[model samples]
Target: MKIQSASALFRVAGMAALLGLTVGCAPQTQLLSSSSVDRPITLGLSAADFEQAAAAATQSMLESGAVERNDGKKHIMVVSSVLNDTMQRIDTDQLVKKIRVELLRSGKVMVTTAIGLNGAEDQMNTAFSELSQSRKVDRSTLVKQKLAAPNMSLSGKILQRNNRVDGNKELVEYYFQMTLSDLQNGLAVWEGEEQISKLGSAKGTSW
Candidate 1:
């Protein structure tokens, strides 16, 4: 009886240990202290600011006649690498896609998906290949009409800097820089940079 009792107690202890382990492994949400919660956070502008800046920058580049001057005829363009060097993680392609779409809508530039960082733009190449294969035209004649080469390539980088005045407040600055490179000459014919700064508490308890 004593041995059975000891075994039961051991089982209970093991179950309790398992329960404790499971609770420890569970996800936890931390409650911020009042001081941390009360810290000030301010943006120079709201989300609208980022969106507007991206749109405006893209528009300025397209309207600047840079594309027209390079190609003479409206030419195909491919957006190349964009490096993000900001404190906050952001998908740089969001800005790139916006610019690509805007350029397409402007009817001033055609973006060739056939050529991209990874071989070809998936959808464009797939469609183009299908059309070429299924077309009834003589293959030699089709080959003579060369696929349009990209006249310009767009690429750039984003840079970030941070400064802390005291233990509490911090300033973060970001710069978005982009360049339109003439593919023929391998030169950056146009370049632009936009800077944005924000001030906030260090702990991210606020904002």
Candidate 2:
């Protein structure tokens, strides 16, 4: 029998590893703490980062009395663009969704799925309204409704910075900046920034 060359052996081992991955030994999902402290560190942006920031930012806004009104009615809010300025691909909605939920639950603000920066967030609103106008549908069954215009707009940006801490370690910093503005006056009502930083091996990649 002839012995395989070094490259051939490596190729066989790689193929075996790939086959093993396709069959089993996959990673199991583990639940993580949403709290900012006592959590595992990662190179890229994480769910914990968004959750913590959203909770804190929402609480701060609630305490600022920006959403309060004399009429005892909740403020209507529309979500705007959330720019991601990090090196890694990320879904900015994770942060916004948490904040939206919190604000809605607080009973101080209501998020409109009928209006958005681009268009309606829920297309069902458009479809249902169009169906109501159709002659095929009974007019008595359809109730005339008016869509509420948003009084406030929310926008934000997520930014990242990296620097070498030492010969063997590097530091990465993330900044989440958000602003709430009044649609009528076009003035900022509330603004908040949350920063998270971590130190890791210099060879690590954030992206």
Candidate 3:
């Protein structure tokens, strides 16, 4: 019986070792930084593409005389409708977020999270604003709330066009367009467009 038990233990150990060896032979996967990747794998849009578009648009907007203020006060801005007219299913945030971060870093425009075209970008603002109505909450802690309206409204659209370059290669052009409008006058203060074109195999759609 001891000999049989010893033999079973040896078999289990051997199986585990074999399993470990198989796992080790499998392909390795890892995370890659988007900034480090300069080449696109397909005609589809990538993080690099988004970064490029954001950089171009933000730089142009800043250079445009529209954002300049003699009052030395940062303009409060709200992100309005950013429509994705492309063929791919894309969250417009992929483009808008980078632009927002860059603009905030520039310090010329301050974005209000409490206001948006659909609703409050941050729902916490709504909840806090309603804290006075909660009977269970202490009234003394409630601060008088006043939300600032946006000085400028930001809106944009992403568009795509595809054409056959050859039997195997197709050219895809993507346009990232943006506009900043002064809320007071209802006119566009700045408009920018960044175009990225790529030629690759006409395989599947842009991921």
Candidate 4:
């Protein structure tokens, strides 16, 4: 009877140890939080002005009605490189992407990712060919067809200027410009620019 009791307790302890180990080895998820504090913030140009400029530019192009469907086909567009001449590091692609999205929403323009800076847009093919062994699949048997070339391309740049006054305030102005070019003629059919400015005191230092 004593031996049996001791064996039962040992088995129970072993099972409990195994369960504890499993739970300890399991992955755990952590939660994080963020906070923001209000401080003295000023803008040389108001948010309303920035929004109005963007809206006006978009409206001007739409009202012009210069962009039209390509004989019942979606107008295709490719993205070109953009130059940034600004004091601050900005992602020019973000601005261009917004324009692309708006154009797409209007159902007037389609973007082509198959064409790129070096000419062909499909990097997957080049990567596969460069591999030691060819892993090319027979596309002839594939059902889905490739898309047509784009009819237009989009490109743009951002420029900035900074002015410092005797006071603690500094004025920073940025210009966002974009161009929609006709792929056939290589001429820009539509161009737009939006400017944003901000004024604020220098942080952690005196003027």
Question: Candidate 2 has which clashing residue pairs, if any?
Answer: none
- Model 1: per-residue lDDT, tens digit, 104-201? 88787899877778777666555655656765756665442245689899898878787786888877777778899899899987787788777787
lDDT of 4 by residue, 104-157 (tens): 788877777667676655666445444534346565544444547877877777
Model 4 vs. true fold: TM: 0.61
Q: 3 or 4: which has the higher TM-score?
A: 3
Weakest 10 consecutive residues of candidate 3 by summed lDDT: 31-40
Question: Which predicted model would earn the best lDDT?
Answer: 2
lDDT winner between candidates 1 and 2: 2
Residue-level lDDT tens digits of model 3 in 68-165: 89999999999999998888888889899999999899988899999987789899999998899999999998898899899999999999999887
User: Alpha carbon lDDT of residue 6, candidate 2?
Assistant: 75
Ranking by TM-score: 3, 2, 1, 4
Best by TM-score: 3
| Model 3: colliding residue pairs | none
Model 1, residue 72: C-alpha shift (Å) = 6.6
RMSD of each: 8.4, 6.8, 1.9, 9.2
For candidate 1, give the lDDT: 0.73
Off by over 4 Å in 4: 1-59, 118-141, 144-147, 202-207
Residue 3, model 4: Cα distance from true site in angstroms: 33
TM-score: which is higher, 2 or 3? 3
Model 3 accuracy (lDDT, Cα): 0.89
